[model samples]
Target: MLIQPVADLLSRNADHYLIPADIVANVQTDNNLYHAFLVLTKIKYSKIPVLDHAGHFEGLISLPLITEQMLGFDQLNVEVLMEKRVSDVMETQVKTVPNVDDVESTLHLMIDNPFVPVVDNDGLFQGIVTRREYMKSFNFLTHEIGKQYDMIEKDFSTSEKSK
Candidate 1:
C-alpha cells in the first residue's frame, strides 16, 4: 500500500491518542516533594504532571530531577529537602500541545518529552500521551507491517515460480 494511506490512518486517529487525566496521577503545586517522590516511585511513571490546585497544567517533573534535588543536600538536610514543594523542582519550561493538535504532531513532541501534556484551547489541563503507551502502539504497527511484508514476499515468490 502507498504511504499516504498509512499517514491518513494515523493522522485521522489523532483525537484518540491522548491518555485521559483520570488514568494518570497529576501532582499539585503545593504538594511536598516527599509525597511527589513517593507517588513517582510507586507508579514508576516516566514523568509526572504538575498542576495547580485549580487543575491547570503547570509543567512536567521527572524522578531524576527530584533525585538531583535530594542529592544537593546532605543526609541531615534530607528532611528539609523533602519538605520543599514540587513547584520548586518541576520544570517550568514544559511544552504543551493543544488538545486539537493531531496525534502525528504529538508523536513528534513525545520524542523529547516522555509525557506530553494535553491542554484545551484555553490551556486547561486535559491529559497526557506517554512515551511508553505511544511506543506500544508503534510497536504493534511495526509487527503488522512486518506481517504484510512477509505476505507480499510470499505472493511474489509464488507468482514468479508459476511464471
Candidate 2:
C-alpha cells in the first residue's frame, strides 16, 4: 500500500517474467532480409530478436527495417531483400536488460519496447519480458491490494461509529 512497499513488491526478479528464449521466434545474423521478413510476417510480430549461431543476443529486426531495404528511388529493389543479411539491417543499439535485472528496470524499458530482451553476463540470449505479461502481474497486485485496504477501511469505520 505504501510507496516503498509497492516499489519493493514490483522489484521482482526479471527471470520470473521471462518468456524463455527457446519459445521465442528469432532469426540468426546470417539470415537474409527476405527470410527475416517472412518470419516476422508469419508471426505477425512487428519485430523479433536477432542472434548469432552461438545464441548470443545480437540485435533486433523489424518488418519496417526489411521493408526499407526493399524501397528504391524508382522501383522496389526486391533483390536487396534477398541479398542483405539480417546483421546488415538489424538495429544493434537495442536496449537489453541484464538477466540479473529487476522488474522495476524492465518496466521502464518496456515503456518504449514491446518486450525487453534479457541477456546473461556473457551476452547469451536468455528471453524477453513483455509489457503484456508485466501488465497482468500489475493488475492482479493492484486489485488484491485495493481489496485488502477496503476491508481495513471498513473495519476502521465500524469501530469509529461504535465509539
Candidate 3:
C-alpha cells in the first residue's frame, strides 16, 4: 500500500512542524507604534506579523514602513510614534496559508514572503512555516532522491555483471 515515488511530496513532516509562540513578534492591531518598534528592535525582524486580540492574523508591520512614515514628520520621537497604531502603518496585503491546506503551496508562497502567516479555517492565527523549515524539507528530499538513484544504479550494475 506504499507509494514510494511520490512519498516525499505526501510526507506530513512540514504539516506537523509547528512554530513556538515565543519566536514570533505578534504585534496587535491596536498596539502602539512605539511598542511595535520596541518589539521589532528586540527581535531584530525586518517585518512582523500582526494579530488581533482574538488571535486572528491581520497582516504585517515592517520597520521600513514605520521609518518611511516617521521620516515625514518634524518631531521624530517615541511619543510621536506612540500616537500612531500599528494598524495605521501595516501592509494588509499579505500572503497567508491555511493550516489545513497542503504545505507545498505554502512553500511556493514563501518565494515572495519570508514568513507566511499560518491561519485557521476562520482566518485566525496559528503559527508559521518559515524559510528555514522549508529549506530543510527541500534539502532532505534532494538527499533522498540521490540515495534512491544510487541504490537503483547499484542494482543495475549487479544484474549486468551476472550476464
Candidate 4:
C-alpha cells in the first residue's frame, strides 16, 4: 500500500518553533559570552536549531561542545567563551530535506543524520526532525493505515448494498 510521505507527518504547527522561553535567550552576535554556556546547557537535553540574523540555518550546538570549553578554559567569561557566534559554532554545511520528499526518503535521510533540518526550495528553515520525531511519524502512519482500511471496507459494503 502507498504510504504518506514523512513531510505529511511533520509538525507543521508553529508551536514546534517556539523555543523554551526561559531556557536560553536567543543568542546574538553582541550578546554576552556567557550566554553561549547557557544555550549549550539547554542543548544538553534538547536538540534545538540555531539560526542567524538572516534566519538562515546554522549548525546545532550541543552540550558536549560546552562541556569541552568549560574543561579546557581557565575562566568562563562571555568574551572568552561566547566569542563564537551561532554562525561560527553552528554546522555551516547542513543536510536538509525538501518538503515534498517521501517518508521513506525522509527516514533514510534522518538515519544518515539523526538531526535533519527540513527546508524549502529557498533554503528557509521549515522545521527540524530528530530521530524521535521520525519514529513518531512511523507510529502515526500505522494508525492512518488502519483507518484507511476501515474506510475502504465501509465503502465496499455500501457498494454491495446499492447493488
The best candidate in terms of TM-score = 2
Worst 10 residues of 4 by lDDT: 12-21
TM-score of 1: 0.74
Please give the CA lDDT of all the candidate structures.
0.74, 0.84, 0.75, 0.52
Ranking by lDDT: 2, 3, 1, 4
Question: Is candidate 1 or 4 superior in lDDT?
Answer: 1
Question: What C-alpha lDDT, on a 0 to 100 scale, does residue 89 get in candidate 2?
Answer: 92
TM-score of each: 0.74, 0.84, 0.78, 0.57
lDDT string, candidate 1, 1-163, tens digits: 2265445545444566688877878788888888888899899874789988777888877788777776743453467446788888888887788873456667778887777888877768889877776676566666666554443444578788898
If ranked by TM-score, best first, what sequence of candidates would result?
2, 3, 1, 4
What are the runs in model 1 whose C-alpha is more than 4 Å off?
Answer: 1-3, 72-76, 136-163
Give per-residue CA lDDT, model 4, range 75-157, as digits (tens). 64435465554444544566666552445555677666765666667655666656665566567765675654443434588
- On the 0 to 100 scale, the lDDT of residue 134 in model 2 is 78
- Look at candidate 3 and tell me the lDDT of residue 46: 84
**Model 3: per-residue lDDT, tens digit, 1-163?**
3246435543646665558445667799999888888888889888888888888888898888777767745665556577899999899987777772456677678888886788888978888878777677667776676755444444588788899
Tens-digit lDDT track of model 2 for 26-132: 99999999899999999999999999999999999999989998989999999998889999999999888886346567777889889999998899999898988
Better of 2 and 4 by lDDT: 2
Candidate 4 lDDT at 17 equals: 29
- Highest lDDT model number: 2
Q: By TM-score, how accurate is candidate 2?
A: 0.84
